[model samples]
Target: MRAYLIAAVLLALAIPVRGQAYMTDSGRAEFDSRVPLHTFTGTSDVLVGRISLPDSTVDFYLDLETLDTGIGKRDKDMKKTLETDTYPFAEFFGKLVSPFDPAGGTQPAVVRGTFTIHGHSQALEVTGTLEPTDDGLRLQAAWELNLDDYEIKPPKLLVMKVDPVQQMRISALLLPESESGT
Candidate 1:
């Protein structure tokens, strides 16, 4: 009887008590860079992310090669400039720093984490909105980053140089584990 009780307690401990974790592999991430002569955008829909409702933890990552700016030549140049061969991915891993109710509708939250790019990592805090949905949650955030901070050289076209600072946007629809099909 004692052994059976112990087994039952262990099983209970192994089960997730809070809300389920959600994830998706087709999330979107994009950046817009504006120069005096031109403005362009690069986007990637291969972002992989996970959000654990139990712990309010968030993690996201994507391949550098997945970014497309609509121009093949420019995309190739970006890949080489970003040193995709050396640092193939950009990632963020952190926990929610603000109050979050997974079932309480949309709310603002701050996520504190390490943002890694171009082989460099920096501590960052991003503010975004979290909205609960039937399947899971939708997260959206916009932030700015300076190229020099990551040792990334700004690209130039002839005499026109891209801005050292660029605006970044992220939008992801997270599906619960059961709906993730994995």
Candidate 2:
């Protein structure tokens, strides 16, 4: 019993922390949208993701409610437009289109999979770079998203309209499940 307890404690303490962030909130996700004369970006630090080795599978999710555009009204309007109450998360699960040598330096990774948002799913292919870190792997990926494809109606700000086209990006440091403590 003591041995088991000590092992668990050691594993819990083995994980490294950057600043005050942990595996769950260490990642970043952002989206940029333009509407004629206006361009705004929404960002969140609560991106959660993982990359499976050997199989080369990648998965990530962001809580829609966590996104902030610096304006409170805009965030609420955006959530309403996204129907986030019904679908609170945007998620992607896909297999890497190419082989990645973990031993090598940073490499480009292509993934094709389904993206779900606003209760709708659409097929998408994205490209990103992956680099190995001492604690885990760091992955950064971006792709263009058509809100209409996800059945998201762009919100209107007074007389201004939000663009249906959104540019999305995510950067995450994914530790092994054992080290992640969850």
Candidate 3:
């Protein structure tokens, strides 16, 4: 009788709640840099941190070693040049600056946050569209970043041949806190 009661309680708890949310371990974080001489593309592992949906606060961790751009030598060069040993990770802590009401439909909001890279932090305003999906909240935004701001020097072979401009775009599936159970 005790076991039966325990199972019943668990089933009750498993029932779908209004604010349930879920997170994916395979979340993607990518960045690209295009110059007149060469182009650089890489991906980072999106590590999930604390997330909120109702109030719109979220945090993300990006593993620095996970940067992969197909070429092995370029990846190695980045790690050595950027000094990833000192900064193992980059992070973003942000909140939806505008009110988001998913129940009404697609919520238009700006996620104002600070992105830390290579021990340097920069205030960023990611302007984008956010919508509710069956899995979680999908945030799509394309933002450009300067390597120099984070003290990252663009790799060059001919000394003056490479441009230091880097462009980055990010799309994240932010899971709801209620469903995450954290």
Candidate 4:
């Protein structure tokens, strides 16, 4: 009986203790770029992301081909300009800088991470809100990025060109990995 108890304690100690990990494959990411004469908006609903609760680590990625700007020609041009053929995906890996309480209501948080686009990576800090849901957590964030910083040249039309800076927004609902069904 003594040996059994000792073995049980050792087995329990060997078990890994980990925070809940949540993931979502249908998240959304959007970008808006406007000029005086033209306004361009692109959206991708194929974003995949994971968030580790308690630890406050998060990662997300979306295929460049998933972006739709409503115009075929414009989408093709943008894809070519971004060199999507070479860099297939845009990804972000970050950690929450502010303390998060999962049981608490919506809380403001800052996520510091690296944003990789078109084969270039840049350090970025984004302020967003985090809220607990029945499944897991919901995150909403908005930030601006400059095209020049990523070595992406602004696309031009006949008389107007897209703004050098673009507004980006992300909304994701992540369910616990165990409940994500894949």
User: Best candidate, lDDT-wise?
Assistant: 1
Between which residue pairs do clashes occur in model 4?
A: none
Which lDDT value does model 4 have at 72?
A: 93
Clashing pairs in 1: none
* Stretches of candidate 1 exceeding 4 Å from the true structure: 1-7, 17-19
lDDT of 1 by residue, 1-182 (tens): 99999999977765763237888899999999887878999999999999887787899999989999999998998899899999999999999889988669899979999999999999989998999988789999889988899999866768768788989999999998667874
TM-score of each: 0.92, 0.83, 0.76, 0.88
**Candidate 2, backbone clash total:** 0
List, in order, the clash count of every candidate structure.
Answer: 0, 0, 1, 0
Give one digit per residue, the lDDT tens place, for model 2 in 1-182: 99999998877665432211224346899999897798999999998876666456667789999999999998998898888888999999888887787688889988988889888888889999977778777888899999878878775658677678899999988776667865
Superposed model 2: Cα runs more than 4 Å off: 1-25
Error of 1 at 61 (Å): 0.3
Report the C-alpha lDDT of model 3 over 81-132, residue by residue, as the tens digit. 7788998777778986887776655766687899898899999887767777
Model 3 weakest lDDT span, ten residues long: 16-25
Q: Which candidate leads in TM-score?
A: 1
**CA lDDT of every candidate:** 0.89, 0.81, 0.70, 0.88
Q: How well does model 1 score by local distance difference test?
A: 0.89
